[model samples]
Target: MTVRRPAAALASLAVTALALTACGTDQQAAPGEDKIKVVASTSVWASVVQAVGGDGVEVEPIIKDPSADPHSYESSPQDAAKVTDADLVVLNGGGYDEFMTQILGSSGQGKPTVEAVEDEHEGEPAAHEEHGEPAGHDHAVNEHVWYDLPVVQQVADQVATELGELRPAEAAQFNQSADRFEQEVSGLQGRVGEIAAANQGKQVIVTEPVAHYLVEAAKLQDITPPSFVNAIEAETDPSAAAVAEVQNVVNARQIVAVIYNPQTESPVTRNVRAAAEQNRIPVVEMTETLPTDKTYVQWMDAQITALQSALSQNR
Candidate 1:
């Protein structure tokens, strides 16, 4: 599949690599440089590569916390330096990490970039619209496809393919990692299904669209507050009317829990959690970005359990 790059992608990287020729006379390499150096756009993507890479790779992630939004990222010269040096780069593709692309675009990061969301599953069904693009070159679709399992499976397959080729010596390890990742995806699909079918059609609310795919997978009905979703896109506080609308949704609907995106914090969440408590509804704190120590499957399983508890509350 063709990985979309800005018009200047190849030109920038080509120029930079040429400039490097003027800076240093000796060809010095990074210490322990035998491993494949891959750049993952997010912490979640980084963790998956780490899982699949094991000893064969050294994966560096650009955004590492639950508190930062990739939508409004500030890329520095240092970030460009990292991308320029990468052997392979992975991005969420539906335009989620524009900063990543921008850094690479300018720094001359000609290293092969795998579009995690769009490259792998161009035709398969996905849990969300972020899955694939039209057969042509349009890139205006939803970009947060990593929230779905099929999209993630596609991501793993693409990542492994790149790793296998870049580090042919680690081919076996990369293949094994891909196989294990695929199995984990299947297992996650089953577990998510079990949780969703158990509380099928149960009402839920979210601070962001992070868990939209899983909510779809688990069959939880989302009564997402328009204010929260909108405010998030604008990076501002919600209006009083929006807040009132959210409170009304929680109180009127038997909303089992509010799946708050840890990455996207809001005073709205705090107030809504209190409101949910007053209404005797539960709150389930969720993360779109993975923790430093979690495997992808563990993170996903915990989320399923959290959703189940929220949905089954006071039922």
Candidate 2:
């Protein structure tokens, strides 16, 4: 999605970034700066970097608000300044946060950058394919890759490698931290597997495809109509027929649960939720960013548990 930023705002940010550059505040650790400065596009990735960097890094996320829509996020001068001053930058590429690209492009800095979905943009196959998922899984069409646990693990390892390159003395520590984090992620994956074993082939629906990877991992079928999904993702209203079809499915309780994204709620999505509630079908919220005071793992664990509970209740 193309994120529209005011040209005047971008120009002002560019000028401010240039001024900061002229002040010799390069992308390097200054005297008495003990931690590496890492900037991420969202708090989800920021939390991952923090886990891997442990006490050796200071991570800042531009879009930390859980309610904010990352697809349409606007960039500010302060955000540009953060990217310019960051020793390393991490972003979920694949057009999810184009604002980060705009800021980085204008900075003209050659600092190292890590893109979680870099493989997708580089013409490489999707991460799901690499992990032996079914060939039919359209991971490339779903940019919300953070829902993919294996991809998250890979991003953690990449973060460790990038941090190690900056501080060789702590390279081993970073790798070890990443390993520990991956172990925890594995535990979460195990829970997902249990859900799959119990609820395989069960039908579910989503207002948006934000949790596509997670649903796929659970072996649950997403019966959301394609036209409805396309319209919602494109920020348009679904046709009356499409909306009625989804509502009918919910009213019939054909799906076990409705995976709703409250962060991107619209009248249509809310209507779907209402129909699900009226039918006593479970509605589980899946957000794009971390909730307040929750770590990435904690947030994901809660979501998985919620999904399992919803499915179990249906059973």
Instruction: Tell me how many clashing residue pairs each candidate has.
Output: 4, 0
Residues 122-183, model 1: lDDT tens digits: 43323234434322112334455666788778667666766655555565677788889889
Per-prediction TM-score to the true structure, in the order listed: 0.81, 0.86
Q: Whose lDDT is greatest here?
A: 2
lDDT of 1: 0.68
Stretches of candidate 1 off by over 4 Å are: 1-33, 118-141, 225-227
Clashing pairs in 1: 12-108, 13-108, 66-263, 94-143
**What tens digits encode model 2's per-residue C-alpha lDDT throughout 95-125?**
7888998888898246567677643445533
Q: Model 2: runs farther than 4 Å from truth?
A: 1-33, 119-121, 131-139
Question: Pairing residues by index, what is the TM-score of model 2?
Answer: 0.86
lDDT of each: 0.68, 0.81
For model 2, what is the C-alpha lDDT against the true structure? Answer: 0.81
